[model samples]
Target: MNQSPLVIGARSIDVGYFNVKFTLGRPASHGGPAPVGNFPAIAPVLRSGAARHMEGVAQPDGCVVPINGVTYFVGPGAAQRGSGTDARLVKEDYATSDRYLALLRGALWRIAGDAGDAGDAKDVVIRRLGLGLPLNTYFDAAQALRDRAVGEHVVGAGANERRVTVEQARVIVQPQGTIIHFGYTNGGKPLEGVTMVVDPGGGTLDWYLSERTTPYWERSGAYPKAMLACAYAVADRLDPGWRDQPAIVDRIDRAIREQRSSFTVQGQEIQMAEHRPAVEQVLDESIDQMLTAVGKMDDVDHLLFTGGGASVFSARLQKRYPRLKKITRMDVDPIYSNVRGFQVVAEADLASAKGW
Candidate 1:
């Protein structure tokens, strides 16, 4: 309920896992905020089934345990998933990262470096905090190809660098897209009516269209161009000499935060509206590319946008198809819409597996 800010409901979060946003549809009968776990319970739910999966227990639900008078739901997931393995790896890889984060925070506070660290730091945090495996597992796989040295180095001194860049991972279509569509459509039937989804996220721009039967998506149409590009575009237009500045990216972020599309160069206002025709142009082209990808799915009816990007680019969307009746932005951040959508799908999978 980020957008409409809906009250949360029926949530069974892992016992003692804090950081969870639990907003019930109605406040608890006492009408006071529910207390959250303030500290990690050393042995919460220590003997649950999930613990069996993790440290070997008899049940799937982790056993209940108590530490310091705090009841802990030490389940299979926490060790099998949370701090035990995952947190260990993060602590390993980013050994100095908190110090780095503090440094980064200080720099950002001082406006010393780019304020754009949110995206990069997010990426770093995501890679570090991912489940199942550490990031080195991913990066090492890519490095393996370099160690093998495919095709005798096609280019020059920069060739290996280019190769590595090319090998850098990308979002796979099926994994993410399949979940995205299933959010509303169940992934069995094509979304009916003129449908468009604009998913703008920390890393990329996702666009889609579908009308019927087969989910509407154009693999190539899903561009990696992100919202920060818009911010950068605005900056370049305002500062003619910005390319020469080390603080250019930071200043661009600063300008965007300030709400003036352009930056100050020697006290002259640069008309960003005139400068980055490309951001707007890309917006339009992206829509067209989407239509081309989905190819007139005649049954589709709406244009729905989700992602952090949507909040920023809503005006551009309003201009794209002024005629559509339901040109709506998801009531939540687009990035998380797909997440909640996936949660629904995952729950459904669990039910279906149980013969529901």
Candidate 2:
């Protein structure tokens, strides 16, 4: 068994489909590591055997990273990599793979590094960790993920060989994380009525209803392909050939994230801003799909939106579902809201456990 760190409490992490955001416990002690990116797949920077954290354009000293023999750019500066037919989006099943775990370690590395910047002399240790799993993930799968995340040691050989340890951990369903977030932020606002949470993330669109009094979630649904539809639609408008090239598709997706007006396609410029209509059209379709799956959530008093991708289309969402009496707006970055909620939940759990 791995030894626990010399920390007083648990730290929380939210591993989203698009990003990994985490918060340190008693940040005043560990130094604050603001939410870090889950930038995928490390690439070896040329000539040094050192891997770059995220995508960027090739510098005079840079080269591309390969995954399964496919070369692509990751993280920042990705736009400079130019377009390729083999570029790929790096996503994995959090419940079944190490991708999310690696990202979690990445978050820890940032925390420790930040602590160093803050003049702290000890490495960061999380006595407990709260992890978020996608809604509708099976119980067994979530348990497996929780088991893997807790007490699991990860050494980021490419990421400065940074390490993080969790003495205890618990998994919160992703949608429920949003609910806890809304409830905690609302403060005494009765969560008694029906409330719906729609988390449109990079990989999945998760929706669930909670009847605030019962401590249970209802009618939870996961729409796996909804978030990608907009990117696909925008790509279709830009280049019919993009679908055939994972790299080009990824670039288009990145362009969407950067809110860029254009992206390169085999040395040609494809205007993205002009494709807003396509994006809106696809977004409408996605909403329609969600509405169909969610059916009519009658008497939904609270409609909270929290996810990395939620803010951009939240206005549209609010307009589309105007019947919701109170639309909760997140005061913090929507991407970190779920994790913040997870932290809140973990603290509550610890409090109950410790009789504090």
Candidate 3:
């Protein structure tokens, strides 16, 4: 397919979404050193929230780092109908989809405030969405956008759809490991020189060294490594009511961001600090168990750690062997690591095929 392909780093809403990646430099990789001038000619893609980080470092030369990518806001337009087995139930899922879109608009307004007509009310029907909102503000906002979307004088308004197809993940799946690998990316062969991969994100974590480096985008599985789960699970077990309190998420989030063992929680009424030794012991035991399940050996690992959860778990991973040699950060937010690597692999393959 002669397509102008896309390589996207994720947005904020996608904190736990799939295809996030990890990047590791060769040995002797140093940060904040003078630019080495040997970085492979690759593009960085960001959308929604994550774009701001890339803007701060686009090279001082003003060379316009040549951003060739798309910014997709994957809310609202999620397909309202269930295809294949449940086509007949489309009407059943309509309300669910509408409620979801309403919530998505609420989030959008949260991101892009009342700037103009896109942010205006009155044009759209502000109805009750049944959310436990403090007020029906989003209902008012969504109605405006919905009206503007379908209204007259607005060219291709409805065409700017946000829905996703059931098959939207084709590129995110690995061809192999299908029947056995639940939610595995349907596979395509890896490009040469593509052996290592690290995929990090919220919700789950995953990594692998392929027997052969397939295009990273072509390799997919349920990213089961969750940086948040462990800590929150710890928090939950420690306090059953923790989930009900937003303070716990905030505290854990702070601990993760600062890379500190401690942070404030329980509305600052309590402090949550990791017993690193105990946490790592439990963590290591779990990783070892997962290693067995994924059919990997402890020695001779070519692994990469990529995901939003990478930083959070990396603390415990510090005591393990070859920490300097094997561990890598594909980017600041490890969640975007895999998809970006996958983009590089695909681009490299394309270049090779053309004998460039």
Best by lDDT: 2
- Write the residue-wise lDDT of candidate 3 on 121-161 in tens digits: 21222111111100112223334433322211110113121
How well does model 2 score by local distance difference test?
A: 0.59
Error of 2 at 99 (Å): 2.6
Give the Cα error of residue 30 in candidate 2, in Å. 14
- What ranges in model 3 sit over 4 Å off? 1-194, 215-225, 266-271, 274-278, 294-302, 323-333, 338-356
> Which scores higher on TM-score, 1 or 2?
2
- What tens digits encode model 1's per-residue C-alpha lDDT throughout 1-356? 01221111111111111111111111335333222111121222233322233356553322233333333332222333223322111122321222212111211111111112231111110000001111122233323322322121111112111110111112122123323434444435544565566665433456555444344334224544445455545655655444333244435544543446666655766555575575676556555655566564445565566655565555675666555535464533333334333333333444455577
What does the lDDT come to for candidate 3?
A: 0.31
Name the 10 consecutive residues with the lowest summed lDDT in model 3. 126-135
**Per-candidate TM-score against the hidden true structure:** 0.40, 0.72, 0.42
Give lDDT: candidate 3, residue 89. 13
Deviation of model 3 at 205, angstroms? 2.0
TM-score-based ranking, best first? 2, 3, 1
Top candidate on TM-score is 2
Once all C-alphas are superposed, what RMSD does model 1 give against the true structure? 18.6
